[model samples]
Target chain A: MIGMTLILKKINQLIVGLIFLYGIYIITHGHLTPGGCFAVGAVIAGAFFLLVLAYGSDILKLRKREEGSSVAESTGIFIFLVLAFTALIIVTRIFFTNYLPKGITGELISSGVIPLYNIAVGIEVAAALFNTFLALYL
Target chain B: MELLLSIILGLMILGAIYALFARDLMSALISCGIVGYGLVICFLLLQAPDLAIVQIVVETITLLIMIAVVLDSSREELKEKKAAEVKLSHFRKWYVMNVILIIVCLVVLLYFFKEVTSTLDPLGKHLTRMSTAYIEYAAEKTGSANLVTGVLFDFRGYDTLGEATILFTAVIGVLTILRVKGKK
Candidate 1:
């Protein structure tokens, strides 16, 4: 399908970068902010959606990138599982234990493995949702 | 705030009714979106910023997915089916029965809700034992400033893991169903 008009395309091009940046900020700061992995992941997917709407699916170079996103989705969940199991293997030997140091609260790097989990979830969700979008369009 | 909430909820219900009755599938989807955003607003009013943020994004994604599905289908065929083959009186009977059943269900639900909430502590003062512990100790235990995130990813990590697995399964199912095979 063809995309929108030139003015719409210009607007989408200008705003998509900002959207991605905001989504990244939300995902990274999930431990300290109201937003979390699922929310920010949807936001990032939304950026992709806008791009697809404004420039058509061809703009994504889907043939090359589809497999990449699928891999990323699997890798994200794998990383998340690894992180969870590492805690189980290490300190407490219990599943989903927080074995890492709980640094000072409110710091960027304070939340030990929580931030990492958030990042993993964010990647998984963003990739999965984008892949779903691509599948529907293709 | 209560008045505003009531107004928003009333509008949401109106939108839902509109969606139910809308002949055009696209307009019905739009009405569904309106109701979704109205719920987002309700979440914000309830002081759940996290829920509000998540709801809005989820709503957007859902709307996009629905739009894609609708676009992929033949709209002309859907439009042509608008002319009902069944008589109006036949539908009126079913519609009245449905309305009566809904009213009965609503009354039963309202009674059960009243009974359940009456047994619990008053609204503003109520906090279950586990939640109180979480609020008091989640910061010290998890070192996450956001208690919701701490509870979701750390304290209740297994639940989150299960959720992730569910999403993964859904994606796999979608990919499997939609995979395009090359002819040999």
Candidate 2:
């Protein structure tokens, strides 16, 4: 563990989880909210950075994430393609069509496939960027 | 609103110029961040919360990366200079010339700034012609209240797909570039 300071560690313990939760909230509520995939992805990546910066990059909990980041990235893209192709192959003959049931206008589950896309993109961008950070960091 | 945005814009430009001239790479990088964060404020002022969120996050991430780079590269201890007087004189000459050139550039930019402003539509008076269709049908057709996501994920999903692929490729590229040579 390459910790910088005890103050940073204390601050990070208090703040990083909230930032991560906020990122998840942004991703899930993307259809109803302003933020979506890319924004939330960066937010989550920032959370990872904050944690690593405080607790050191060698945190065993996060090491698994960095290790599987490439796989996670591919999985995200794969899910996106599967969602699109499902729209194409199954019911709607068009690509990327919102085939799922559209719930209420302002509800969380309202936007048919938009939230799904948000989740996929959030995963994709978060993993890719976090991977880069772990790599470039000394 | 326009006045506030303009002030922020001026600050951004000044910060950019300061970043160019600042001797300490750390402060220079932080001033560079001023430009990015200022744009986030501009986005919010323009009623684009989506863009503002995106901009701020990406800006912070990039800034953190830059901070890491600078922190790793710069030494904590200062090294004594062997030829301080001669180096200072030579450095001052080059710095003065660069400052003069930057001032000339700033003058040209300021001179043209009015013309550019004159051509632009006032803030918040943006022409809604291109966005009107999305504004109308995005909610109904896509069933998403946030029209930005509607258009991005449903309407023009191919673009999003391509964007994701591009990010994947970039990650691969970075990993490749950073790979340790002769390490299995």
Candidate 3:
């Protein structure tokens, strides 16, 4: 029975990891696919949920009792705004306009602001969701 | 053409009514879920996949949060009761309010939906028609595979920042509500 339980635990972790990877895949392919920042973020959050359920609150890596969660939440917001402000400043000063280069299409390096925006959004959403789960669960 | 539109409209109205009139909080919540599902259907009908994806995520999170809050509050109540003799007065009251709120919310949402769809401009039309070009352009520009990310972060990055801040505020609100003095 104990051995069975241990194997089940390992399988759970593997499943969670797969789910997390799937979320990343979805987020990264959001623009070209059916998923997006929100979908992928929520899926990533689901991975955490799976972990919490499998290991219980005590074993979860992202704890609700930690002050770091709140800090992380704010940091995502701060980073997003700082990046945006930087872009705005650079555009207004150097290029004489806010026009960033819209590079070649569908080659993993296009869309001036779209990918950066998606990533920022993904991070923001993941952190916010984790914070929410922690606050409620803890 | 009209038949399809009317079917969707009918589903929306029915979902709204069910969401509002359900007798239990859980049932009311389920109704809300239906409302959300209906909204997604409507979004698809309008051919707005981007908006639909965002809406699904937002709705799912909202539902999760609501469920969490409801679960947390109920635990305390459950502990104080013998589980058998517990009355559902609060649940009943919430249901009544839910219907009223759903009606009000549906009216508001329906109005906005009609207005937005009608007012879609030439630029909006062009963007949807040529979204592939934008997606391809975004991929080469942002060094990311996610086109939504490219557009949202690189082009309209400021809006994303604002959205992050709103989420941060919600986290703070949750913390403030749940935090206990002298308890880690």
Candidate 4:
């Protein structure tokens, strides 16, 4: 039984790593492809769901979902607001203006605010979906 | 053309009937989802991807909540309260009222669809002519092939802020609803 548990833990770790990489890929390639923050988050949440399904609610007990989810939800909102307000107060001198420099098109590191926004949304969605699943499972 | 419209109309009517008569609440909810999917198709056909996406997201969230609520509610067994018996004439009147309301709503929707399609925006023409150049110029200026992203996040950043706030409001509402005291 102990050996089987160890094997399951190793498999779970591998699955989690693969899912994380896929999430980043989707977020980065969001500009060029049909996939974006929401799709990627949904995918990542799906992986988490699979893990929970395999390991049961006992495994997710380690995460303490309510606290983690609230923090994620609040922080995502803060990040979104701060980005918008900073752009407004500084660059265009107008509230919520896109003051960030448009760097270059089609580059992986391009689209300054776009990528940042995507990241924020990706975090928000992943957290929200996970929270929903946790809430339901619990 | 007529055949397509007839088939669509028939499907919609059948869906409504199913939604109305489904024995289980979950089945009714799924029928409601079907109705929403139908609306999404209509939105896409009307050339409004933004609206369609928004509608789809909202429907997904609503369906999730509905399923959760149904699950929670079904877990409880409530005592059956005595029911007030209705007269035949009263039942007939109530049924008539509901059918009239449904017919009125359908007619209103049909009229709205006709009006909107008749005044369709020349967006497809505009997109074909200018979208590539717009993307190029926007990318050069704003540094984003994700022209939509550039427009959403930078050019019209305020709109994105509005969207963020809307999401934030939803989050707050969810927390408020879900937060239970002494639960840990």
lDDT tens digits by residue: candidate 2, B1-184? 8899899999999999999778788889989999999999999888899999999989988888888778878823244577767898798879978899999999999989988999888756657676778787888888898988998998788899999999999898988877544124
Write the number of the candidate with greater lDDT, choosing between 3 and 4.
4
lDDT of 3 by residue, B20-68 (tens): 6665677677678877877887777877787786677668767876775
Model 2 CAPRI rating: medium
Tell me, by lDDT, which candidate is best: 1
Window of ten residues with lowest summed lDDT in model 3 chain B: B75-84
Better of 1 and 2 by TM-score: 1
Error of 2 at B162 (Å): 1.0
Best-to-worst order by lDDT is 1, 2, 4, 3
Supply the global lDDT for candidate 3. 0.65
lDDT of 3 by residue, A34-128 (tens): 66676666777777755664566667444344656566566656665655566557655432122546665555545455555566667778777
The residue ranges of model 4 lying beyond 4 angstroms of the native Cα positions read A1-22, A38-43, A62-66, A85-101, A132-137, B1-13, B36-91, B94-139, B182-184
lDDT of 1 at A105: 98
lDDT, model 1: 0.87
Write down the DockQ of candidate 1: 0.81
Can you write out model 4's per-residue Cα lDDT over A82-129, one digit (the tens) per residue? 777786677767766546565566778766667777778777777777
Cα lDDT of model 4 by residue, B1-184, tens digit: 4465456667767887897767688888888888777777766676655456556655675676677678657733343444324455567779978899999999999999999878776534553645666655776666767566667666666676676567656756665555444236
1 against 3, candidate with superior lDDT: 1
Going through the candidates in order, their DockQ values are: 0.81, 0.76, 0.42, 0.38
- Model 4, residue B40: distance off in Å is 6.0
The per-prediction i-RMS, to one decimal, reads 0.9, 1.1, 4.4, 3.6
Candidate 3 backbone overlaps, count: 23
